[model samples]
Target: MKKRTHTRLASIVGLFIIASIGLYFILSNLEDNIVFFYPPSDIEKITNAKTKIRVGGLVKENSVVILSANKIRFTITDYKNTLIIEYTGILPALFREKQGIVAEGTFVNGVFEAKNLLAKHDENYMPPEVVKTLVK
Candidate 1:
């Protein structure tokens, strides 16, 4: 009975150790993969050139240049600030000037290189933060 109890305790402790190690690995990976979202103004302050991130703001009115009806260049503004975005993919149907947008990419050579762009949909909906900025 004593030997059996000892074996059970050892098995429980081994399982606990394995679980702890697994938890640590998952948490570490989560930290490494986490990406931050910022507005144009926030992106301007970033200095880590290699870190991937996202920018969200309102597309500037009349700033869009449809290079080929597919490739597009535009500026996203946080009212007092703006960032130029270049993308060469099929833009979402909702993409337009003066609308809310979020772009995931890197900033290099004084431009935001967008890998993906998401445009706001519908007149009744605007990103809450952007609307608040516009109201102020």
Candidate 2:
């Protein structure tokens, strides 16, 4: 009976360790996939180059510069600080001056190299994150 109990306890401990390892892996992957959101004013606080982040603000007036090769450079501002974003490929229909938008990418060399843009807002509608930052 003593030997049987020992074996059962060992099996349980082994299963517990396996479960802990699996859980750790799952949580780590989820953390890696999470893209954090930040306002333009707070952009200077981002220090991690490997992590992707989203920046939300209004398009700075007359800051859109169409570049060659389907690339475009623009500025975003929360009326306090501004961030420059460079994106390649077609832009969204709602992309315009004074409009609110969010761009997701890595901040490199003092510029945000956007890989994705979220500007699907309609008239009289803006993203909650943008509103929150601008309202302050």
Candidate 3:
């Protein structure tokens, strides 16, 4: 090959290697950080009931039970099903019945054990899948 042709081939090969490395890191980061969403029904089918997962649903009406100053219990529903969620700590003002919520934790003894609770901030918004479920 001519000198110029050789240089061009090397440049392309170097670019391909760089791109592959970048893509690998990006995918690895996503796998570690991304949390999968599982509805109430899916949680039951999961064999690793002890594994932590994210559950999104609406707070069931009249289910907010305050057990103590820092502890609270409530039922989250997907309209078709419900799961009791327990949290101990300050809850967001937006955390209330009939509103959307995403709880992150494991399920233990029939209760959705939550380590963190995130309440929807606005009345008109909901996670897209949850909203779609509610609509149908």
Best candidate, TM-score: 3
lDDT of each: 0.83, 0.86, 0.83
**In the order shown, what is each candidate's alpha-carbon RMSD?**
7.5, 7.8, 7.8
Task: List runs of model 3 lying over 4 Å from the truth.
Answer: 32-36, 44-51, 123-136
lDDT of 3 by residue, 1-136 (tens): 9999999999999999999999999999887236556667666667777777888888899999999999999988887787888898889878878888889988778887799888876656678899899899
Off by over 4 Å in 1: 44-48, 67-69, 78-81, 122-136
**Model 2 pairs whose backbones collide:** none
Candidate 2 per-residue lDDT, tens place, 1-136, comes to 6999999999999999999999999999887346456888777676787578888899999999998878999999999988899998788888999988889889777789999988846577878899999999
lDDT score, residue 17, model 1?
100
TM-score of each: 0.66, 0.64, 0.69
Q: What is the lDDT of residue 56 in candidate 1?
A: 85
Candidate achieving higher TM-score, 2 or 3 = 3
